[model samples]
Target chain A: MKISLNKKILDKNEECAMQNSEFFADNDILCLNVISSPGSGKTTILSQTIRDLTGEIKIAVIEGDIRTDIDAKKIRAAGASAVQIETKGSCHLSAQQVTGALMAIPAAGMDVIFIENVGNLVCPSDFVLGEDLRVVVLSVPEGDDKPIKYPGTFAKADVILINKIDLIDYIDFSLERVIADIRVVNDKAEILQLSATTGEGMENWYNWLRSKITQ
Target chain B: MHETMVAQSIFESIQQLTNEHNARAVEATISCGQFNPINDEVLNFAFDLIAKGTPCEGMKLNIKHIPLSASCKQCGVRFDYDVYKPGCPDCNSMEFDFKEDAPLLLEEIELEPN
Candidate 1:
């Protein structure tokens, strides 16, 4: 006989994500899950944002890496509490892992928490860690066709940041094409162009982030 | 890939369901939407690998592909389209609101009394 279950296969993870979401909501923490490819400057962006908004906003980071805590150390250096989750070989961060990381950090009185997901455009998009916003970073070096190529990730982005804009003149990246492509995949994603290293156009990002915190 | 994790979850769900029903699963059906970037072959292979030595071994895994449906912003026409090439069928407008339901689902399972 055939039994109709009709359950979500990822329900275990989804349930955990819901719990995390409730935790954030109860604490009034604005959680952001950041996803990107290997060299898309996710760490640099978070570090810069932490440094820029150090006093005004209390930001903590849960850094996900395959094996190391290098990014977490950088986040600590930038003056925010950081908890590193080494996934070992997993390509994505699960909600259960985030729960452990959340317990490790002193989450009291924090205005915002950023979950820096594993550097994988595909896997990280599939797993939700109870974040209020999903940020997908596409560097100028990653090409303009990334939105269409990785529609699963781009389509779900709350905000898309085109990092490495300072190298736009030297690289063959098309800013207009990228924006148009992002529109095709996700019409509602707020697109921002900035250089994390050079600090150009970062004020817009900071403003947007601040506005989100207030709301 | 992420499919490995998904497959492991599927295995655990099947194990739990079978245990509750006091039977063994012989076949299973899953539904995946266009928005979900799951490769069926990879998912099947991973499932088989994980199911080995378990009661779910040799179970037939059937996957159903669900296309995403969207409503046009300009013409107000609803249609199904690929996520990669998203556009309205009637108005050809790129602007649309996707009406996709749950992307991945374990729909049913065929069981045998053990």
Candidate 2:
């Protein structure tokens, strides 16, 4: 009997991602997977979010990076519990790693768990990690052509954060073009334009976030 | 630097196969999907490090390029991928269910005598 080994090898990741989601649901914790290119202001957005919602919503973070405890430290300094998971060299964070990190934090006390994935636009989208929402960050500097260039990331995202709007005037990005392209792939995703540096569209982002957790 | 993971994983698989086969060196032939900014030079450098002096000492590496393919889920139209011209040619709808870059992967290795 010839068995299909190759198919399972390629698909094990997605299966594990689903299992991780079930684990989070059982614990009654809403997880979020944040995906972005390097320096797209993920750490900055997270730092700001942690500051804005710290004690009000007992948060815990499991930071995934190829290397660095910097994000976890920032979240820690923001006055929330944090853990850093170094992928050693993997481009994306696997569900096994996320589930392992979840065990370290007390599930009962935590209202939300944010999995700040490795700074990658493509691979992270393919992996789930049991997130209640998959948020993708695309800064103005990354250009308006990104959604078209990297469709998989845009398609996988539930919310698209067009961050660093303060630099919009300086950059040659067309907000309309970006939205138009994103709408082509994603019809239901909410696009919020904001700057973590300036706190422009953060209110809407916070509301979108809160609504998900409450629901 | 940030490109096809299928290629990256192929490089990893070759280094492992060389060791498991107890080959003195590996002769890898891989079909690289599309012509993106994947630095073959950098991949070779990485592969060298990953396969150094283990079972595979000196190997000839080869990479073949393939183009991107996409099929729109809306009108069910399929075509070769165009980065700048993303919308479906027939429908003119940017809502094409375009597939990301992926090579039709086939790995072949030369083994030394056990």
Candidate 3:
């Protein structure tokens, strides 16, 4: 006998993500899920953003890492309330874990909550952590081919940040090629170039964040 | 890898289907999108590791790869293509909405009668 199941494998995660989305909407909070390859400057960009927006907009962070609380500590030191989620070797943060992290953090008055996902372009793209915006960071040193190599991540990004632009003169990275490739996968994604270290082009990023909050 | 989690979900779904029908699943078919980053070889290895010591042990796993397709929002042309080339061939427009053709689906299960 043959039986047809025809069911989605990740339906459980999808359901939990939907619940978290509803919860965020009810609280009037904007949640951003940040994903990228390891050492792509997700933490640095986040720390800088937090510092720039401190006191003006209340922000909280949920840091997802495979082992340590290093990023969480950095986020806290930068001024936002932070909670760490150690996945214990899991490749990605599931929706269930984010739900728990949201409950643990002091989200009462937070205007924005950033879920810094584990630094893996492949796996994190598959999991949704109930976010209003999905941001993918690509550093200049990582080359212009990442969007084509990891299309899944770039395809799902609402915003793509080309970080470490200050090194463009020293490195052989082609900004035009990167933007063209990203456009091939996702035509509507907002692409920005910025250097979190020198703070150059960061105003565009900050302005984009503000626009999202207002929307 | 996360393939283990995906395999576990498939195994659990098979178990539930078997329980409801009062039969044992002998084989299962799964379909996934080309855009999905799942490596079929890795998925099979993970499935075997997870199916051990369970009712789904030794069941044959079959996978169907679905090519990505998109409908051009600008020109209203529907076309199928590889993940490497996401732009529409007819209009050369990147402005398009892709079809959800590559979902990981537990398509069917062949069962043994009680």
Candidate 4:
């Protein structure tokens, strides 16, 4: 007799997500799921955050991409243990992928673990990787309407970093619009505007990450 | 799943719904909430195509768009869709209990068997 495979697929994913969450809790590790649209500085922020917090605390990074280990390379270059989760065809990273990456990284001894999600604004918000915090990035080049346009991702974020602030003068991103739109979805999200390239406003993000680990 | 994969799933949703119910389905309804990243326009097209060869061919498919609604575990205020920003609208607290469950639910099946 053939068993129903579709239902099993969903059940497996849920089980994996719960197990991943349990792993994070048992180890007293703080996992951060960082999501953003393509090229919204998810990796760059990971790079910067890793660099700033590296020596002060032992941090590791898990990079999720449909293909390539480029982001993982960047995170590794910034002096941290990095692992890559290649989803291949899956648009978003599941709890299993994240947990698999967690196995690669030494999260038990690390201060913070940043799981950079696949660069899609839509699907990753659905699966939870048992992260202590969820950071969503929106770059200046991505424009202001992203908050409301991809509201689900934004609404799920613990911190909204408006990256690429160095190019604010050159772009059409409206802080007012992003703020207003974010307010409609998440009334009290901490909005931090910074440029990972220039490191102009990187302190707030680092501070936030530190605060989460401390708590 | 890629964009095409999701598109295919939408089509599958329409086909599976009809197959589970009947060959000629009338007034079929589906619900896609704000949380699910589904392209209804494409889903509609997929539904039309799927319905063409099946019993529910040419049957009008209706979709009910569900909004995101969550309640705060601490404050008990239900919030919806905007997951990126759900600090309580009333308390200005960042911790909100989000009610974004399964977005694509086949709520009710309508079939007219001949």
Which is the leading candidate under DockQ?
1
* lDDT (10s digit) by residue, model 1, range A83-196: 999999989999999999998898867999999999998888888899999999999998888888888898899999999999998888888878877887687889999999
What is the CAPRI rating of model 2's predicted complex? incorrect
User: Model 4, which residues run further than 4 Å from truth?
Assistant: A1-11, B1-32, B40-64, B67-114
Among residues 3 or more apart in sequence or in different chains, the pairs in candidate 2 whose N, CA or C atoms overlap within 3 Å are B34-B66
lDDT of 3 by residue, A70-153 (tens): 999999999889999999998889999999998788986788999999999898988887899899999999988999888888
CA RMSD (A), model 4? 6.6
- Model 2: per-residue lDDT, tens digit, A1-215? 11111221223455677888787787777788999999999988988988998667778889999998988999889888899999999998888788788777775577788888998876777656778888899999989988888876886689999999999889999999999988766778999999999999999998998888888
RMSD of 1: 1.6
The clash tally of candidate 1 reads 0
In candidate 4 the C-alpha lDDT for residue A149 amounts to: 77
Task: Write candidate 4's Cα lDDT for A13-104 as tens digits.
Answer: 55787887788788777888889999988888888777777678788888889999998898889889999988897888877787777778
Q: Is candidate 1 or candidate 4 better by lDDT?
A: 1
Q: What residue runs in model 2 are displaced by over 4 Å at the alpha carbon?
A: A1-6, B1-85, B96-114
Per-model lDDT: 0.89, 0.74, 0.88, 0.73
DockQ, candidate 1, comes to 0.74
